[model samples]
Target: MKILLLTLGLGLVCGLQGLDNSAKGSPKLDGKWFTVALASNVTSKIEEGGSLRIFVYNIRVYDGFLTADFFKRENGKCIPFSVTAITKEDGSNLVHYDGLNDFSLESFDDEYSIFMLYNIKDGEVTIWGELFGRTPDLPDEIKKKFEEICERFGIGKDQIRDLYNDDRCEKLR
Candidate 1:
């Protein structure tokens, strides 16, 4: 009985170690990402109609910290802004940009994730999200996952916008 219990304990430890190693190898959110889809329920001047009107992000990860340059689309224009994305805690996969306009990571996979952006002021909270991918397009499976996230967040299907094939920012690259 003692030998069997020891074997079980070793197996559990090995399983946990393998899980941790696999997580380390998961895709890192470091690249030039384009917005593929978006959804939100926030109503503010910044988030007019609760949608990300125009945006693409070039994110760089440095020692677990994140910084990004935003290319905002407007009136047939792509405006630019630079900001730092802060990791909320040690060993936590989520990162965020905390400011007048806050952006946070809700979840991620190999090609894309549901990124949430929000603004809170005057005791009001306004949240928006974008499906950001390394490229302009996402695989069908990834797209489905993003849709699921939107649904779980109570964002209507109609409210989701697909920015995947929009190549307006090609010149910026």
Candidate 2:
């Protein structure tokens, strides 16, 4: 009985430790990020004045959740917003926000990351490809890569929107 109890305690400790590590997340992902571009299978969702047309500025992870700081233009004014996504234990970085969001880090380096988001909201599914850069502007090649990714996901070139020069909420920072 004592041996069984000891084994259970050890297992519990190991489980908790794994959870803590997952909560801490990768340091590389915890930092300032700029919204360079956005594309979606549902073009209207990424179009100007769309609900998904948000400019992200920061990302941080804590307690197994990833929170993002961003701004959305409303009534010709920039409105600050924040959303938290619960990181899954499956190591997929999947999170639930306004909907079920499954994020895949398609590509990443020191300066940029392209995330493809599969979201299901209100029974409608949308796939979005987002390009985030360490700087406000990325090279044309990077943009072209993002376009190719979007195309692969059935998002047309016309659906992509460039937001590098639309930092209207910089003052709020």
TM-score of each model, in listed order: 0.66, 0.75
lDDT string for model 1 (1-173, tens) is 44532332232211111122125666666677777876766423324222246566677766545667776666666667766744332222222333244444667756775665544445454456678887788888887777676676566666666765555466776
Compute the lDDT for candidate 2. 0.71
* Candidate 2 lDDT tens digits, 13-87: 111113232433432666788889999888787777877787888977566566888888889899887887644
Model 2 is weakest, by summed lDDT over 10 consecutive residues, at: 8-17
Candidate 2 clashes between residue pairs 3 or more apart in a chain or in different chains? none
RMSD of each: 10.9, 9.8
Cα lDDT listed for each candidate: 0.57, 0.71
Candidate closest to the true structure, highest lDDT: 2
Worst 10 residues of 1 by lDDT: 12-21
